[model samples]
Structure formats: structure tokens, C-alpha cells
Target: MTTDLTAFAHSVFEAQPFSRFLAAELTDVGPDSAEIRVRNRPELQQQHGFLHGGVISYLADNALTFAGGLALGGDALTAEYKINYSRPAIGETAVARAFALTTTRRQAVCQCTVHMLGDGEERLVAVAQGTIVVAAKD
Candidate 1:
């Protein structure tokens, strides 16, 4: 089950140019969950040396959508989402993990949590909730 979706998930991630630009990698994906990881680079940081809010939002949005798509068994687009920043995000690495909160025939509610890895410990940085609209199958 997971093995099949693993390849599909990686393909979907690889096909996103923006994900590639941000160096976001799809680490895992299943019927109801997905995980992505990105390295902290200077170029991805804000003036305050924290990862920019936009970067965190990007992770949340994409991770949530990927989770929804897996649960829906096809493509989906982000309809809307909101992210709450817990603190200034600083670390050598960052991870976004998303799970389906609810799913319908054409839509899904997903939650994403962002974490920053520093000194071998992970700290919560942001949380997001997203609505995803599944695409019609051909």
C-alpha cells in the first residue's frame, strides 16, 4: 500500500518546480498523511535570521495538499489555509508533517505542523489548517 504511494508522492514532489527551488523533499506519504523536509539555508531566512513566514506557509500549504491528495486518491488544490507562527524559526533543518483531519468525496480538511531541528532537538514552529479540493478523476 505505502510502497505504491511512495513513488507517486515522490513523483508529485519532483514535478513541482517551486518545491524543487526550495529544496523541499517528500520523505513519506500515505493515505492520510504526508511529510516534507527542507534544509535551512541563509537564502531562505528573513532579516531576523529566522526562516521567513512565507517559507513556513509554503511548507504547510504543500504538505497539507499532498496529504489530501493521497487520501483522495488523486490530485487536489489548496482552497484556503491559515498558519500560526509559534516562534521565530531557526535551525539546520525544518520539517512539515500533515494529516487528513476530514475527507469527503470532493474535499478534505488537513492539518500541518512545522518543526525546526536545532542541536539535535526538534521544536515546534508553526501550525496550519487547510482546506483542499480534490480534482475530478478522468
Candidate 2:
């Protein structure tokens, strides 16, 4: 079923203070997919002049979590996650695209890929996979 993914993303942003701190924007959200973007700011950079790994991982994780939530049509929490960094994120902005791979009554599995935007090359930065548990509204 189609869902209002933008509304759901906004609710998640409102509930997660750290997502606000990261300045993450939900660019795309559909029944089984979502995308988020974050501009590279000094605070998010490391001494090496590249985006910090943790920040990239966080964005990927959040994207996957949101995708899972969209797929489940309810609140969901990440039960496990894995990330692989492919390159340094040194661009002005990073974008992550997430999509659900599978879903059941209780869980959803999602994957996200992060890339540096600009140059139209869309070079890969990182990839992540997550399993999320659907939860009842509290």
C-alpha cells in the first residue's frame, strides 16, 4: 500500500534530536524506499577533512530505519545494522538512498547506499543494511 512517507519522516525528525542536529533532510520516501541528505559542515568533519565515519553510518542507519518504518506502516526500531565504507566523503553534501529488501509481520530488512553528490558521478561512499522490528504505537 502507498504511504505518506514525507509525513512519517517529519515525525521521525521531530522525535529524534540528533537527526535535527545532523541537519538531515528526507528527500524521497515511498512505500518501500527513502532517501536522506546532509550537507557537509565543519562540525561533521573529522581532522582528515572528510566527513566522519560515524556521521555517515548514522545517516545510513537512519535512512534504513525510516525505510523500514515506511514498509511496516508503523513505528519501528533497528534490531541490527551493518555498514561498509567505500570511500571518503569530502563533498559538499552526501545523499543516502534506502529501500526495503524484505518484510514480515514483525520485521523489515532494509539497505541503504550513501554517495557524494555533485559532479553527477554519484560516487559511492558507504552502504548499510538493517533489520528493524515493528512496534506498537506507544
Candidate 3:
């Protein structure tokens, strides 16, 4: 990613208060892909002591949107998405990786996978697919 684009992505991310509260990091934003990482915290866990499903979903959603936005080369918003949780997220950190699967003039289809990283290994926790459309300009 170009330095300008990287700055733009970070600025957009920093504008989200919820993401900041979660301590999420926009680790990478590229032409066709994006990545997000969040450190595990007790407040983010559920009854079973695993990362809450909402947290996993948030990571996937943001990653997919970022990928689509990058593919579109401008602002974009998620149209809709579906996610499947394969396993509990149990790790020191969670990582979401997303890529644009297809793109048109105004929209892109994106896929995302969320993983739990711990002890030198990563385990799949969730998968998601979403459609993103260019944001309407003011």
C-alpha cells in the first residue's frame, strides 16, 4: 500500500470509537485485502471463557469491509454479510484476514476468515462473506 493510502486507512479506522474501545488494530490495508488484529481480554469473553461471538463477528465484518473498500479504491459500506463460527476463539490474539473475491464499478464481494492465534499456532474461528458498495457521497 502506498503511504498515503495507509494513512487514509488508519485515519478511517481511528475515527471508529467502538474499534478503539476494543483495541483493534488495522494491521494491513492493501489493494485487494485487509487485516485486523485484536488482543484477547477478559471483558471480551463469554460464559465459556472463549472470545465472544460478537467480537469475532466484528473483526470479520471490518476486515471484509476494508477489503471491499480497498478494491473499490474509495469509501464503501457493507451491504450485507453472512458468517459461520467454526470454533470458539481461544487465544491471546485474534486475527481477521479478508480479500475481495470479485469487484464491479460500484461494489465488491469479499471473503474473510478469523483466527485465534496462540502458542505459535492459529486456529480457524469464523468465516464470513459480504457485499460492499461504494458509499454515497454527500
Candidate 4:
């Protein structure tokens, strides 16, 4: 299959105004998966000196949305999503990986795992699952 998940991620990232604010980068993408990384900049830090939960959640959502788009091979929109935080993310970079778990004519189900990388180890920070609604092509 001629799946260009990376291209789809880049397009989605570029289309979102807030994505630029997050400074997220699409590091890896495949037929049914995508990964994103965001540096721990000063602006992204919270009061306790850890990355904010919103930032990580945004990254995770984007990754999952992109993965769903790749699976459907069409325009998609997030129907619903839920995220659970496991720990505070205190690291130099936050990484999110997402994959499509299932797909139907109108919806795609995706899962995303977010991790904080620091001290040479990656710690699970959050996880999310979402449904993306795909629209018919013109």
C-alpha cells in the first residue's frame, strides 16, 4: 500500500494553528502508526518544573489522529478521545506513538502512548484512545 503517514501527519500539523504552538515534530510514521516528539522548552514547563499535561495530551491526540487518517486514507476528524496520565513528565523531550487498532467505513479507532524521555530512559506519562470520523472523498 502506498501509505504516506508522514505526509499526512505533516499536513495535519501544518493545518493546526495550535500545533505550531506546541512545537511538535512528526518523528516517524508508517501505514498504521505515527510518532511525535516535542522538546521541553521553557514555555512548555509547568509550575512544578515538569511538562504540562495539556501539552502531552495535544501531542498524543495529534499522533492518534494522524494514525487514523493513515488507516482510513481519507480526511478525518476526532470524534472523541480520552487520556489518562500516569505520571508527571519531567524530561527533555516528550514522545508520543500512535497506531490504528481498527477501522470502518465511517470511523477509525486509534490508541496512543505518551512517554517522557530523561536520564536515558523513557517513562510512560500518559495513554489515550480515540475515535476518528472519516469523510467521503469528493
Off by over 4 Å in 3: none
Off by over 4 Å in 1: 136-138
Worst 10 residues of 1 by lDDT: 1-10
- Which RMSD values do the candidates have, in order? 1.4, 1.7, 0.8, 1.9
- For model 3, residues 3-93, the per-residue Cα lDDT tens digits are 7777877898999999999999999889989999999999999999999999999999999999999899878899999999999899999
TM-score of every model versus the real structure: 0.95, 0.91, 0.97, 0.90
lDDT at residue 68 of model 2 (Cα atoms): 93
Predict model 2's lDDT versus the native: 0.86
| The candidate that achieves the highest TM-score relative to the unseen native structure | 3
* Candidate 3 least-lDDT 10 residues: 1-10
Q: CA lDDT of 114 in candidate 1?
A: 99
Candidate 4 local lDDT, 30-114, one digit each (tens): 7777888999988898899889998988988888888888788757778899999999998889999999999887788999999
TM-score of 1: 0.95
Report clashes for each candidate as comma-separated counts: 0, 0, 0, 0
Clashing pairs in 1: none
lDDT of 2 by residue, 56-83 (tens): 9988988898889888887788899999
Q: Which has the higher lDDT value, candidate number 3 or candidate number 4?
A: 3
- How well does candidate 3 match the true structure in TM-score terms? 0.97
